[model samples]
Target: MHLFSENLAVEIATYYRNVALGHSVVPKVFTLVNGSGSQYLFFIDDLQMERADEDQFLAYIVQEHDAVSYSRGTLVIVEKNQQYIEFAVVDEDDSEAIVCSAELTRDMDDKPIGLSEFEKILVKRESIVFGHLYDPVKLSEEKIEDFESLWEEMKPKILHRTMGV
Candidate 1:
């Protein structure tokens, strides 16, 4: 699919804003499929990092990776847990696998660091990218089921608050 970056950006922004406003626990990201395939990018949210553990962190990466793989597109997971969030890309084609991590560091002058430093860090994390292939069609269907389950779980809480039952 020929995914447009702008559309993806908008989706990511909207998702993030909703999450920030206490609308949902769903991760903020955009998923689009074009003629070529599908692509996703999780927006970095510094505030959400506090609740992130290594398992959740890794699972998030794997989830995105699987999403792209299933949709036959590319997935980019942006890590907002740290001062400098990193973007890690995963491709469906094994041969196209190129893992990189970049950190945004500020200099003494309060200016951003150069691309060279970013590239260096990206190169260093190449060995960490690992995950199984995920089918988007199946995942999409499963997500619907999950959402319904979530609604069911919240029904009691909502009723309790509204009716004092």
Candidate 2:
């Protein structure tokens, strides 16, 4: 099945936006297919991250989601007491997965655009799969150092799972 549909993304975003109002953090929505033939739309706020211990976090997720089924074209909302809400669809399998996200933003440029200008904008917003994308507003070097440290802490754990070491 196609991973992303623009219309679907907009609808999902809108629905979550209402439910997520007044939350401390911008809610994150993730569409994932598990090892089983199940698909899920997970919406979680970062605030929950602050209070959850490792075991509580694991338990919360495990108990909240289990193998379930949904109609092919129906969107089901799950009301669970946890960090985020979930919508589930099952009976589909995925060997590989890719993610796409979209946000409507006002164009900041105040100048007329020709072909060259348009190409520049596209390049600026282009997604980079393996490395950081171009950012007009650069982060401070100190901030970069802090981010690098955080990445280092998780890098080995990720590599161990992804590389099967």
Candidate 3:
């Protein structure tokens, strides 16, 4: 509904530029929610549609996900069942990246854990962030459709960033 930050202005501009140039911008688009730390950050796009409210937004996503048979874009819903490693999630000059970790994590309750469990804490509050969400990954149409389930399968092989360089 709104730019995640003032920096997103450039991201929005780039989206338009790529659209104008007919580039495959899907990979570059990063839709997010200011879930306010109550929800797992997810990368979701509304296909650039406008909604009057949260109900409308979620409904649109569910409908479109089905109408296209979940074959259109990426969907990464963070879940606790998967293995996670610490990374420095950095925001720099209108861009974001997950970088090598210093090795530590904390849950939503702000509790230090033997291991990181971000999504789990958020999920315990609810199945998924109802009003907002966050996830960390990329996708293909086929993979996007079943992303939540296919995440582990693809995590090891995709993304230069995920390589833990």
| Candidate with best TM-score | 1
TM-score of 2: 0.26
lDDT of each: 0.32, 0.29, 0.28
Candidate 2 Cα misplacement greater than 4 A, ranges: 1-26, 30-43, 50-64, 68-92, 106-165
- Against the true structure, what is every candidate's RMSD? 12.5, 17.2, 18.9
> How well does each candidate superpose onto the true structure, as a TM-score?
0.32, 0.26, 0.21
User: Which wins on lDDT, candidate 1 or candidate 3?
Assistant: 1
Q: Using lDDT, give the best candidate's number.
A: 1
**Candidate 2 Cα deviation (angstroms), residue 101:** 1.7
Tell me the number of clashing residue pairs for each predicted model.
5, 0, 6
Candidate 3, overall lDDT? 0.28
Q: What is the lDDT of residue 1 in candidate 1?
A: 16
lDDT of 3 by residue, 49-81 (tens): 333333343334333332111111121224543
Error of 1 at 90 (Å): 2.0
- Write the residue-wise lDDT of candidate 1 on 53-151 in tens digits: 322443433354333331111223344322332233333333333232333333565444422222312122224333232222233556555544543
Candidate 1 Cα lDDT to native: 0.32
